[model samples]
Target: MKKYLLLSAFATLTLLSCNNEGTSVNNTVESMKTPAMENFDKAFKSLGDPQNRPTEEEKKRNTSELSDRRKALLVPASKELILSLGVTESELMRKTGGDMSQIIVWATQIYMKKSDEIRKNIKSEK
Candidate 1:
């Protein structure tokens, strides 16, 4: 009877823990978002949309047009912020090779680090 009681308690706790996992994950993700993430999301969205993608025909026949399109993928705000951080536009374009995902990753890392510094300074000032 004691063994049976312990088993049921363990099973109940396990089930309750499982139910909390989804909420915990969502809360964590929500808390992690910052204004800098907006730029990352915008670039990612433009890259992810099929309609915004360069066609295979364009890749083959109109490489210059494709390059221009890829360059344009970086929104002006993002471009300005990234450039202000001392990363040259050409260097970023070369590093990302027109991959928005890469740019998103790079920009998010830069922004998050800078944001952390700003927060630290604000707290220290207080």
Candidate 2:
């Protein structure tokens, strides 16, 4: 009886977790329609394609694109703010985790998303 009760409890918990996961996915998909999400989608797509993954050159290129976007969008004024928030140039470089090229690609995506938020706030203010 104890075993049966435990099994039932586990099943219930599993079902609840699955339901929550479904809801989260739905919400995430809905949220992806935003401009920031669109940029994220593009950045990730450009970086994560399997063909891009295998070649060092492609990976480096992707990282360069990300860094460029971060610079272009955020400009110099936001550098301190971004650094204070823990997304500093050094931190981003660290994120590459020794994979020199992949580091660049991922960091760019991170900054791009941040820039999108800043832009959104500016728009809201005006």
Candidate 3:
């Protein structure tokens, strides 16, 4: 009976330690957002707003085409997000020829790649 009690106590302690470690890892991952990640998240979420979403007519029209005015609305946010990712304005302009669509696309790709790296790091740590 003494041996049984000692074994039970050890098992309980081991399970508790494991649960705490998993919680700590989860909290660490949740708090690992960079400024660039936040900027990209905010920029993408802005598109979900009612005013930013395309209207039915717009959907029926050239759905892929963004009017200059619409592009202008997103340009500042896109620039901020891209710049946060360590690209200089001059380099961005040179690479994209000052095109808003190219800038947004490049920023999105960078954000996705960064996110992938973070996920891989978390998995490796686990």
Arrange candidates, best lDDT first.
Answer: 3, 1, 2
Tens-place lDDT per residue, model 2, 1-126, is 999999999999999999997787556555645454445446456545553443555456755344444433323333333344557687745654544345444545555676577557555754
* Candidate 2 positional error at 108, Å: 5.7
The root-mean-square deviation over C-alpha atoms between each candidate and the true structure, in angstroms, is 8.0, 12.1, 5.1
Model 1 Cα lDDT, one tens digit per residue, 18-105: 8897667555554554544556556657866897787786677854433446546654545555666678879989987856556655
Cα lDDT tens digits, model 3, 10-75, are 999999999998898767655676776676677667777888887777777875777555676667
- Cα displacement (angstroms), candidate 1, residue 15, comes to 5.4
Pairs that collide, model 2: 63-104, 63-105
After TM-score superposition, the amount by which residue 67's alpha carbon in candidate 3 deviates from its true location, in angstroms, is 4.4
What lDDT is reached at residue 54 by model 2? 35
TM-score computed on alpha carbons, candidate 2:
0.31
- Candidate 1 has an lDDT of 0.66
Instruction: Report the number of the highest-TM-score candidate.
Output: 3
TM-score, candidate number 1: 0.43
Give the local distance difference test score of model 2. Answer: 0.54
Q: Look at candidate 3 and give me any clashing residue pairs.
A: none
Residue 74's lDDT in candidate 3: 67
Question: What C-alpha lDDT do the candidate models reach, one value each?
Answer: 0.66, 0.54, 0.77
